[model samples]
Target chain A: MLSLSSQFPILVAIAPLMTAPICALFRGKAAPWAITTIASAFAFYISLQLLLTVASSGPISYELGGWAPPWGIEYVVDLLSGFMLVLISGVSTGVLLFARESITKEVPTSQLGLFFAAYLLALTGMLGICITGDAFNVFVFLEIMSLSSYALIAMGERTDRRALTAAFQYLIIGTVGATFYLIGVGLIYMMTGTLNIADIAARFPEIEGTRPILAAVGFIVIGLAIKLALFPFHVWLPNGYTYAPSIITAFFAGTATKVSVYLLIRYIFTVFGVDYSFEGLELTDILLPLAVLGFLSMSAVAIYQSNLKRLLAYSSVAQIGYIILGLALANETGLTASIVHIFNHAIVKTGLFLSVGCMFFVVGSTYLKDLEGIGRRMPITTFGFVLGGLGLIGVPLTPGFISKWYLVVAALEKGSVIGYGIVALLMISSLLAVIYIWRVVEVAYFREMPEGTVKEEAPISLLVPTWLFILGSFYFGIETSFNVGIAKAAAAFLMGGA
Target chain B: MSFGFFNYWVFIILLMIGLYTVMSRSNLVKKMIGLSLFQISVFLFYISMGKVSGGTAPIVVDGPLDTAAPIYSNPLPHVLILTAIVVGIATTALGLSLVVRIRESFGTIDEEEILEMKDGA
Candidate 1:
């Protein structure tokens, strides 16, 4: 039975990889959708098995191609990785369904199979990146994900020239980030003589005071910061999200950056060790304030955007701030808050973006002015968006609220007035979120309708998946047992393996 | 710090050239060249690290005559760098393809000019 967990990782990864090629066989719209749905479901089931196995036993280690760790490639599935696998694959299954109808409207029929192929390839990369324990293997999987993302975004060129440029811009930044990461990894290898991440951690402490290791940490963090779009490095996200086709925007918003954040956490906590990460340097002092500024400033910018998709893009950056702030706290509670929010944010953002896809279906424009009185016409979608918006604001009875509560508790545990002040500042940021959501709601509900423009709600196909996430936000909000339990365990591991 | 330090200096010079092209140059192709150089800098870093004071390639030979105590350079970093180099090539190719499309669609590979046109639109 324990051996079942080892195969879980490969099954989850290879299922989608195999599906990607077979998806090319089907031509018609229905057939491709059917294949994607089935593949995603299978992948999600494999993730579920992996998660349960990890929960019952402990971290599952599988050496690929019958190779041993430290000398050969390994896939390590602990609580954190298994937890992330579930979130990614679960949301992927839902999104692939939602994308079926949404994509048909956006992309041409001839490109449908190709889009599904790219989708599965992206899923495979994210899953592999989460499970793989080898440091170099992370880079390999990152490229696979990035390459597929570029293709997915570039496929949106038929909709707007802006997507072409956006994809190009992301291509540039992403390439630089990946290159910087490779350099950092190379530097670490130079010092440690190992590519297995756990082996690196075991060896890192002996050379902790060395300059090369320090430099490697610096290079790696900055590179990952760019990939995760932390504050100063987030120039590529808004346009990338806004200009891509609606379905692609929804998928990437929900999955891509979150996967990158998982890698960042894995490196900082698992590979570097928390003491070296937090106390060995002034990294917390440097990172904490930047995170605070990102939360406030990006949320402020998010409020003023007229384009709905772009507004959500900025909000996504602001949300990233919260996660980093949790990391900066460098305590068990703080780590718990960060891990919990990773799941909550994935749910909230997927709901928001899918609702926007709904709007795109009806009105064909995400401009705030164009959506006047749209809520009355498309009540279901608009209501889902509003619930998602409330979740984003950390309103009570939302998953976000549960995470925010934990964050404030974590902050207060620091025993500083400044810590409480950070909570107040977070509260203030949520107020700003309310303002932006209100602006959209006011325009959609209270304002006069455009003459002779009768736009209805999105189809049932889109509505079901969108509501799944929207309801998931509330469901997880009330039922905190799973999130809280897993998060506490994951956090303990992050604080150097309890 | 003698002749070994001299090669390090050349590597740094190439590294800075690559960094400058990525930062200061506006043309996309030039940026790709810069990226390639930047990548090669890391390759240089790995190769230099693998070098032992007096070592040959780490190849094991089996025979009675293989009695000489052979010191060998570290081979793991060299192998990792080979994989990284291939990744770098893929990135360069993909980046250049995007550049081609950008030129075709936007009519400019110059970053500033592209931004200028976008602003005008």
Candidate 2:
């Protein structure tokens, strides 16, 4: 038999993929949750090992069924993919820890088994996307993630019927997006006659300026933009996040769009290469304007939301704008900022949503008015929310500040007037972030508690995992070596300098 | 366009019709029909690409060891679409089920009515 370490790459994906069906089969109350948590923990451990192994040795390529690459499926774990695997699985494990208590309250007891089953399927899909090296496999995994999420989102109908509408709307938009991506992949395959990502990149130089290749790039970028929720195509995000079960919202907030961002990075930087994407197609000119408008307008829109979840949902979109802006900058620092923010934002946003879940657990509402004086009643949960809010505002010693700092430095390195303008735009958006987060603080801390309100905290089961993420973000912010070091290495690898 | 590119024209036209229906319709079931149509158009596009000008089925014959090998059409796209088709069915089923639940809860499946109720709430 092969050594266990030799199989870490595939095991990272298979643990969750294989466990999902078992989760569905178990009818016991706690069996499914136990299975999900254990599977996620296993996947997280393997991913961490994979990341360390890649960082120390080199990229690991595992062939499925002993079939060679460019023919059979292959799984590759490099610095970027390894980092993403750890991020996705790590967040999944943390969120699953909190899920037992939160899901118990929100989802019906009969549906709990199937609920965790879908969660595991979504986790498997995301991990598969990070590890797969084939273009067609990406589309397959993308569908897996999307279909499972639709069911998970619709499960929220038990709380509010609007979730059904939200899930349906997302289903329509998401299917169109995935189909567009498949068309793009088909066009590329027609020209290159290979579905392997590395093989396509190798053959691209010869067919660099061909019409089909250009169209493929156009279709692929647009499709991923929709999936990434880049500004104009982000209509499906806010409602979907707002109406989903709180824990599901937190889970998807952390992993789903970030995976799409990863695919975009892989396609642009690895498959198409920098010269073709930015200089040849002038993609920066398009992405820069959209990024600017996205952050500015979305932040402005966020400030008007009365529901705290809806407000943060809009902020997530605005944060995606910052990541895209970094990609548009197209420098080492810019890409580093983008890559690091993917980690930083996922941690911060997921923590924020979990804190909201904690509040909802106790008080049964997340509206600004309903959260009044919650700081006094639920001190631990409220404090966690405020700290996560500080991260959102890019305060010093928060992961958000580290990324925004890199962004400003990248803009300054441009040494052009447009660069200065982008710096100003970034500041204005952060200021908008302050306004929205402050609205929550004002309600939670300053407003008087309603009559007969008692001091009751969310149960420790939920609070512990919530603080695990909240404090974890703070730890990464101060240490900076783990997240930043990996991000820099990933940026270098993407820029083809490693 | 030449008759040689007829499949391309059909694919583009079907795609446009499906997309327009999805955008314009308010009834949830009709919207789902449109989505299935949209996905089916893509399946057609993929299947069309696998065809070779004068090739036979990809299966191997018994008496071809000494003679020239038979030309076979590409089979990869067909296999990929089979997976996509399964995904499409799942999406359609889930979407229809959600629509059923919406009708049960809200007493209507019209997009405008649902939005109006949400705003009033």
Candidate 3:
């Protein structure tokens, strides 16, 4: 019998791939849903097994089709990637379970099977990108995810024409970004004669200052920045998030950009060793200031949006700033802070958006006005939203607090008083978050109930997933050893140690 | 730097023309063509980098282990470029598809007009 550890990665991708065509072939609602759920369930189970294996052993590297690395493709599973795999697959399963009812309600009935197929394809692409060890493979999986996302976003046809426009704009930007990245990889290959990431890292130091390599760095960083929606490139994100079908919003908001951030970390730390003079070239001078600007400006902008979904979209950009700021510090503590925040912020954002999705399901709109007097009617969901909002604000018991504390500490460790400035800025931003959350709160609880308001909590289907994510934020907050310990190790690895 | 340099300089000019059209022009079809041209410039750059004057095909007709003779430019870059060209074609196709969708939805193919209509709405 094959041990679970060896087969886990292939199983994670193949389950979804095989079921995708099966889902398309089926005719009935129940059968397709069952097949999709089973596939996701199997993938989630394999991911958990893989996580346990990685936690026990160190990184697991497997050669595909029995070919060794530097020539054949490889799959490298380290603690950082295992962390991400569990998150993506686990959240994907939750979203698929939730999508059964959500898709039927929002998408047209005729396209239900097609929607499932696209969802599986997107999940497979994300997993493929996460597990692969080759650069060109990364490009292929990036296209897979992008193409499926465009289809999924365009499916939101009746509610708004803006979805089509958003999808189109994303397509253009995404193609350009991917092409830029391919050019970077090609340049690197021409220099190194190998496309394996480990080989590239081993060779990056010898040809450090060549014009071609610097240009490669520039191209790759810009391409990834666009995908990650770093502040200046984030305009496509707000409309895309706000207008896409509800389940798609929750999934992409939670996982898509997070995966790109993973790639960014991997490329920066693993493919290109961290301690080169290139650090000064990329991080301290340029990315630091942009990250700071992203944090402040996006938060200020998020405060004034009337639409709740748009408001949250801008907040996502601001949160990305926090992650990037941690990375820009270019130290072990700073890198750990960034990685820790990736997981913590993912939990927070997932809870926040899932709560919003619940609100959307009940009220049929996510305008702040629509939430007025909803507190009494939907007390549990309102309370959950309140908890997630406080987490976003970095309250002491919440996961966001841990990430923010580390980021501030990292900045201080770098001998910079600007650490204090960033801490204060973060607090003030939280206060702004409070203002918006309070706007929803006051409208929900303090204001008079609108006439003809119906008394319905969000369906248990939605509430269960939303609460699970909120509880995870708080749980991970209290049990800080796992996140902090692994983050430090991964950060060390990024800083060019074991 | 000689006539060879002039060929490279022309390639750079073509690249800039393509990028300028992509970023500055308002027509959707023109932008697609620009994207294609920009990609073609990169192809030219790779091909130029791999050129070995008076070089024949590097494939060994005798056997796999003719290790002593170096007769040609590297075939690896050419192989890499082939994959890149295929990816480029896919990108162009997808861009055109999106442009078609945009035109159908907005009833216009001009970027400025589309923006104006969006803002007006």
Score chain B of each candidate by TM-score: 0.87, 0.93, 0.85
Q: What is the C-alpha lDDT profile of model 2 across A320-376, one tens digit per residue? A: 999999998988899999999999999999999999999999888878888899999
Question: Interface Cα RMSD for all candidates?
Answer: 2.5, 2.1, 3.0
**Per-residue alpha-carbon lDDT of candidate 1 for residues B33-64, written as tens digits (9 for 90 to 100):** 99789878877877888899799989886768
Best by DockQ: 2
- Across A59-137, the per-residue lDDT of candidate 3 in tens digits comes to 8888888789988888888888888888888887777767766666678777778788888888888888888888988
- Consecutive 10-residue window with the lowest summed lDDT within model 2 chain A: A489-498
Compose the digit string of candidate 3's lDDT tens values, residues B2-116. Answer: 7866657776788788878888878888988888888788777667767677776777656557565657876766776787788678777867876777777788878778778
Total clashes for model 1:
0
Q: What is the lDDT of residue A235 in candidate 2?
A: 91
Which residue pairs overlap in candidate 1's backbone? none
DockQ of each: 0.54, 0.69, 0.37
Model 3, first chain, TM-score of 0.96
**Model 3, residue B86: C-alpha shift (Å):** 4.3
Report the lDDT of model 1 for residue A142: 90
- Using TM-score as the measure, the top candidate is 2
Extract clashing residue pairs from model 3: none
DockQ of 1: 0.54
- Cα lDDT of candidate 2 equals 0.92
| TM-score, first chain, each model | 0.97, 0.99, 0.96
Model 1 C-alpha lDDT per residue in residues A107-127, reported as the tens digit of each score: 889878878888888889999
